[model samples]
Target: MVRATMMSKQQIAELVEIARRDHTLWAALKDRELDQFNQDGSVKIPSISILVEDFVKERCGASHNYAIGSLIVALRLPIRQELGLPA
Candidate 1:
């Protein structure tokens, strides 16, 4: 079993900042395809899986599952922020 390396807060923050500068990546975070709407019209955000998959395909060029895992770690902060979670 391969263990994933944890990203430091600073590292996560930096990655988030970098992602913010990328229009495509930032837009993916806000895309409706990745969201679920409730009966009350409140939104339930999907996990970052789709975004990570897209990121890996466009940037990492790695087809392994680990690429998605690594992306989730790197983009954790930004993903949470997009979901309106407290950072």
Candidate 2:
């Protein structure tokens, strides 16, 4: 049998906050990339996955699994919004 460690509500909230901040930064980076791409038909911005991994490593010093899991959970709202789903 495998045991799972669950984060407390406060921990989850903190993760969400981190995610939101990273998301905002990611959006700005993407917008910049879009503008650059429009201007020259090329993009040089790093991938969002790489950005999130770096952010989580720098901010939380947590494992890759934790970082990815938090990002997936955090991105749910934004993904839904992008898909035109109800919040």
Candidate 3:
């Protein structure tokens, strides 16, 4: 079991960027995607991605990770703010 390590906010930010650009890769991230052996062994996978997508897409009825990832990165990137996302 490959253990997962704690990632810094920058790392999360980087991942947000990566997942935002690559839809396929972003979609691939799942609760079990990370290594099972966490270094701290106290890590808990966040459902933030799914929630972010829903918030961005405004599809609260159905969750979309890709759209969510894009929104997160878009907000962080400051380039695609014009996209049809609620302020």
Candidate 4:
């Protein structure tokens, strides 16, 4: 069973906007986390490092947009691999 994590609609909408604003800005923000489920059979969310707490707070639903943006800014970011499937 592949259970999904809970995601926020508002955050997703914002992420979409961010992607539109800059062509490749958020190209790496796919919503799909690892397929591994928790011990309870629920899917796990992507964990952000403590280094990016402020960025995480600014984002919603694990805010891949914010994380990606921060990564871009730090020049140490990674791209999305979920095939554009945001929460």
Best-matching candidate per lDDT: 1
* Tens digits of per-residue lDDT for model 2, 24-57: 7657534543343445766645554566557666
TM-score of 2: 0.45
Worst 10 residues of 2 by lDDT: 29-38
Please, what is the whole-model Cα lDDT of each candidate in the order they appear? 0.59, 0.56, 0.43, 0.38
Ranking by lDDT: 1, 2, 3, 4
Model 3 weakest lDDT span, ten residues long? 78-87
lDDT per residue (tens digit) for residues 9-71 in model 4: 555445445544544333222222323356798754443233234334455445333334333
- RMSD per prediction, one decimal? 5.4, 6.0, 14.9, 12.4
TM agreement with the true structure for every prediction: 0.48, 0.45, 0.27, 0.25
**Residue lDDT tens for model 3, 24-62:** 534434322333235687644444454454443443244
Model 3 residue runs over 4 Å out of place are 1-4, 27-87
Output the worst ten-in-a-row residue range by lDDT, candidate 4.
72-81
Compose the digit string of candidate 1's lDDT tens values, residues 7-68: 45665455567777888767766564345565688865443667656654555355443334
TM-score of 1: 0.48
TM-score preference between candidates 1 and 3, better one:
1
* Model 1 per-residue lDDT at 23: 87
Model 4 residue runs over 4 Å out of place are 1-5, 26-87
Off by over 4 Å in 1: 32-47, 53-87
Clash list (residue pairs), candidate 3: 3-37, 53-68
- At residue 64, give the lDDT of candidate 1: 40
Which pairs clash in model 4?
28-80
Query: How many pairs of residues collide in model 2?
Result: 0
